[model samples]
Target: MRIEDKITTAFVLASGPFTDGSLWDAVSGRLGAAGAEVHAVTFSADPESHAGEVLRLIDSAAAPQVVLVGHDYGLHPLLAAARQRTGRVARIVHLDTAPPQDGDAPLALLPDPATQALLRDRPQALVPAPAPGEWARFGSTAGLTPEDLERLSALSEPCPGAVLTRPLRLTGALAAVPSSGILCTASGASIAGVQQLVSSGMPQFQALAEPSVGFFELATGHWPMLSCPEELTAALLLAAAGGGRRLTPAVTRPFHERPFVLDAAEAPRVRTGLVDLHLPAAEGPRPAVLLVHGGPLPRGLTPTPRDWPLYLGYARLLAGRGLVGAVLDHRLHGLSDYPTASEDLAEAVGLLRADPRVDPDRIALWFFSGAGLLLSPYLAAPAPWLRCVAATYPVLAPLPGWAGVDPAFDPAAALPMAGALPVVLTRAGLESPEIAATVAGFLDAADGCGAAVELVDAPHCRHGFDCSEPTEEARGAVRQAMEAVCAHLSGRVPIRD
Candidate 1:
């Protein structure tokens, strides 16, 4: 990759995790030769103080206008500074790192969430920088050589565990700031890969498809400055000029807003802040199917999941089938909040069984997406009242990134304990790699333990097919899964047609 035009915008390089400014010496020289002024930052303090360091550098620059180029942990300080002075930044380039939200600490985004929590709780704990050879545990080291590793080891420092413990406050100041992403392919991620995640409506990557953002990819590992300095320089130059591949925002609506594929059957619904009940006009008690919506959704998300079309449609559809439908709300906003979510779910179920209108002897719990984690307890020790478990595109095991989440939340590991509890899972053919792996793992575990699992395949569909897919395959799969769940609720196994 080569840039025809020289770049005049000053580049403020923010180093990630273990490295410092000197790590960018080769890259800085290359940028300087191309007529750009460069300042590689050594983050001597916390994220906020590093922001001040960046601000001071910006203040001392001749043009007083700079492009903030940040890699991994370096992004926190760069983002902090950018939020402070959005007008002065030419562009913010995220170099192969997860872009942190307003309150996201490094621990939340990094691989080991459990270990990070342990370290955070200890008094004056610090995150020890890994020895050069051990860096692969943190990120891909596909392109670095022995010499490169030695150099990287020399240009690094131990991180203070306290950094970003306090949230980086955002005032929506960075919304208008144009941004770019530099993806490292050898790091197990690519520009195309990111687009796929954005298309899934994961919320976090939604901003990447906005008109103000662009993306570039390098066929190297995480540390592009060390592995491919010339190529990195070229991409940075183009990015500074607002030139890179721009993603067209996905046209599919999110699960909350999209109309459910099933036709809405009019049924009377009662709302209780915690659970929404859809009832059939029946005289006696009826079997109930609890519809659990999936999410790590923010508390502020309007028209909560229970009020969403998917949940409402499912509840009404069940009621029309001469059964009671219960839609529940659980608190599951962050990575570490699984315990809170579980407790909320348990309370909702207790309230559900105690209701006069619901037959306590016959009940089924249906889980979806991220709520898939909550399925563990019910499967691990199926209660006599629990009839069946139904899940759609569910995450059975923690994704690779969630290495430190509680192992007890794993449904795959709990399969052996799911004695005779009929299970139905709807799998998506086009699901993302991260999600597909978990679903596959769960099925494999169930097979190994001889657990009863009925699989329904939705071929050529994305993750949230029920909401986004307007095709026959998706609708058919949903119907099949529902039939299996209802059959089990009525004390019988569904016979395949």
Candidate 2:
């Protein structure tokens, strides 16, 4: 790729934790060949100060402009230096990891929360470098060959404890620096995922959509220099020209703006702080259905699920058929919000049961999308008042980034405790392969349990088929599952189609 304007660049490479400038040997060689002045620096070994060496390198650079590249813990030092040298930095490139905020602790940004918690309790002054089995704990080592892993294990240094523990501090002005994020696709983040996060209105992820920012996906692992040095060098070249993928600033329309597959006349609804109650037409103490929407949904969506046709339509349909439809917002705002989300769901259930219009003894819980993990506990300890459980296109287990999540959320593991309880599951035949595997595992687990499992198939549909597909197959599947759930709540055998 031709450099725009052909301006000279001072390439400052900050290698990630546990390794020093040597980590950038291959990358620097390639960059130097391209006629760029490259200087790679090592982080401090001292526990109290980490990036002073990086600052010194930046201060001594003679080039007209600088492009800083950081990988893993290397980002910490690069970011720290960039804060002071904001004017000189032409563009900043983030490799694999998400960029940290002004006050974020690098340790907290580990691949998953569980690892973060474990490491916090056993803090080390100098964290050791990657070993064969230990590499995965830090990040994905997807493309590293056996020899590469050996070199990594042998050459990597110990990371200073202060680098991970200390909160990153910086002036807000750094946002103006043009930036590019190089996604190690094997590590689970991609440009498409970034767009989704941006659309969800998560302020932290929203920055990736800025006009000053762009992205590139490397079909490698967290350690790109070791896995594909040439490709990483190529990406860096393009990143210098601000030539990678730019995220669309526009918010993605929910479900491609698809209309609901099934709808019923709107019912009179009672709005509370956390929930909306759609009162059934049939009046007194009617059986109620509590719909639990799925996510890691960010807090700032303009037309949240409650306003979306999916939840609204489902609620009204339930109400028109003589069931009190209760749609509530839980606190599943981000990945770690699962614990709080469960609490909010429990409180919502209590609130629903306490309502005078709903039958306290007859209520069904329906889980959807990412909310499927919330189904475990109810499956584990079924209450007499909890009549039936239904899930649609559910995430039965932890998704990729959250694989280290608590096992208590495993629906398959909890099925044995369900005993004689009835379970209704509507599966999309065309569900994403990863999620489908989980649903399949849950079904396999159910086979040995006493729980009566009824699988409803939406053949030729997707994960959110109700909203995205809207075909007769989706409609029939939805209606079938709802009838089964409502029947169980009404203390009658559900007739299957």
Candidate 3:
């Protein structure tokens, strides 16, 4: 092959103990056929040091630009290596894998609930390989021959339990490197909604949603390397060539015809509070909606705009409908407790009301998931300017893990305070019991108080339906919920489809 026609050196990092790197042979072979030098790195028992080993291999080759490909658990080490040698890495490819954040563990990223439970209960030494039936659950075996299945099962090994439970420590270097994702659409479908991953307040999904990270989709199962190597290889080539499109289509509506203007400003006197404002182009003093995203897992992590793609999209949707949309980043879970969050929100409300572009009396509150906790107190004697509250799968009850920390965190307790303010509650039918129970109790209180409350059910959705999977049903639910919110704030009866 001519020098320029040759592809760059590619390193294929196979996922942990579920199977040997043999599945990657087809992909590697194809790359070699294309005149690319390919090297496949299998995981060692010590995942903690795997990244170092990969670096050593790259240094030995002295390749100027290396394409780092990670599948599933392999992404952990790949990310670590990329962070250390960002300049040498050409592109980071995540193949049917969840992107790792600064402090994430393999078990935490597992899509299968049962597997997570099993690993949680098992010994924290070396985790044994899954049984044959269990292995089959990872991906579809539709195209694999009997020999392929048997070979894969036999090649599987035990992974270190530490790798599954321990948090992956990473610097922000990977963000600077070009990254792409090859989503196994079938596997993604089997898991909870993708929007839920974001709405549930996971930092990893936030990283994946970066505009810099491009994505490609495959119709195969989780083990795309084994099920659809050709398609996966094609996507890798496109990604390596910097030509892949986003896996999730961009939200062009509302913003397409009437483009919205985005502006940023920090809250007055509050050092940590930053607000992103989206305004319609043809706006005067329009009714405004304050978008409050859910807090992080009660562990005290600060929330960034990356964590609120759904809300950001909604802000644009509101702008498309001629309303000013404001998204506020309140104090993080650990930095500020309930009191601080409420205070920050109040400050944000005041700022919006005072803005000349907003109609103070027509302002609305849109709370997402855990943010509902912050909304509870406001419900108890809402201000005249607070026209209505629209909550999407809010946590009305205290999280079990945080129950001991905040004794006064009951969302139901503050329900009686929602005197006459109209409330539009969007419930995810597939939400967990804790959230479902909170919604039930809150509704009962709202009914007794005779508050104007409207319940919109997203039967096939999960918690954070607004940001959950981008299935047709999920997207439809989000649109319907947002429409309902817009109507409620406008004093019109929400027309449900």
Candidate 4:
């Protein structure tokens, strides 16, 4: 193997959406001046490509060593090329690109149930753009200048509906090289959507046993090359030098330190980890409630303090109800597996019930938003010891226009099972307009099943509100709801004034 300084030649993979190599002109030039040869490969305009195109680019690369960099959806193909010719590849970097999802759908437009229900019935109310000023809210954090944003807005290639919906298959290549994730928090795309993009890569990363991967969360949105070239370059150089891992600082003291394990998983799997319990309380048979974090994609199974606003408070509330609540971080959200998240929830609940300290009949289930859709199917299948369910602002249906490849769940399908179990469905009306109709529809079809529904008028509330600091109105509603649930489950009605 020939060495070119301490660095190898750089090969850029510009694959995804309606983009091409043209986007990397500025960044590539910078690398070229840094004594590295830069080669850019394009599968085709937009995301669709001929497999031969990527192979040709690899064959044309300079011999000895090369660093393969892929951005956005382009990472998939670049990964493929590297597999065919191993030695030719020195390192692979996924810049703001997600690996692959369960479905093949463009990130820009994938359907969720709420989006679908509204669009299908009232397409007229659908605005082409919502709050154009939303971009400005982030100010410079978006990573693009007014001019760059304009250029992208003008030349941006639209992703085909097919590419966005179809899930990429990378089970084979991911088994090969360990890949690093260069998540562009500063540019490229907003975190709201990019979180999912970053998460999609996790499956392959875990499969490769490459959990040692590094991440650079630059404070930028999509299009880092054009918007924040210098920061992006610095990140690239650091990554090439293998200095991209986020580690806890040495100056930290025990009192000043809260353990943030970069790799906290126990022996079984490096990716799996447990968050240390923070709040100290008397060890007793508290209600064992599991906290499942909700996001567009999984972040892993470890629950941080940040998740408290969405789940911990609710767990505390359950504990206040004479239940020892043990919150288990669902896989993929905080640090668990994508498919295994639901399974872990079941396992965690089982652990709670079997703990001799906890009453097996008191075990319950809770799912919110995205997690709701994921777990609802499991609830339908039946699990012993799951006494009741509380799903708030549930994502019961798929988005209409953004249906990604195969829809794993349909809210309509799970609606029927609600009748057979003791369930309490509540939604903060301000969060989702579709909730009223969804709950009403479910209640109408109860068919003598033991379930109840409540729609609360809580402003600026969405899913996970009860788990966080709720407004006075939301708090009141939540208190009432919890009381009602306990009363129903215990088969005793509280005296009403």
Best by TM-score: 1
| lDDT of candidate model 2 versus the reference | 0.78
lDDT per residue, candidate 1, 1-497, as tens digits?
A: 44535566889998766788999998999888887888999877555577799888877767545899988777888888888888888799998875666665655545544445656586246667667897775667778998888888777777766663545556678998999999888766677777876777656557889887989999888888989999998999899888999886777775568889888677998887689999977656788898887867764667788888888888887887777889998877666567778999888888889888888878899999889999999999999999898998887876543422555688988889998999999899988887898998898898899999999998898788888887999899888988887788774322222
lDDT, candidate 3, residue 123?
34
lDDT of 1 at 331: 78
lDDT of 1 at 30: 86
lDDT of 1 at 292: 83
Best by lDDT: 1
Q: lDDT of candidate 1 vs native?
A: 0.80
| Pairs clashing within candidate 1 | none
Give lDDT tens digits, candidate 3, residues 75-173. Answer: 787777778888888888887665655665666445444555566577376666765556654544455656666667777887667777766787766
Arranged by TM-score with the best first, the candidates are 1, 2, 3, 4
Query: lDDT per model, in order?
Result: 0.80, 0.78, 0.66, 0.50
Worst 10 residues of 3 by lDDT: 254-263
TM-score of 2: 0.78
Name the TM-score of candidate 3. Answer: 0.55
Which of the predicted structures, 3 or 4, would earn the higher TM-score when compared with the native?
Answer: 3
Select the stronger candidate by lDDT from 1 and 3: 1
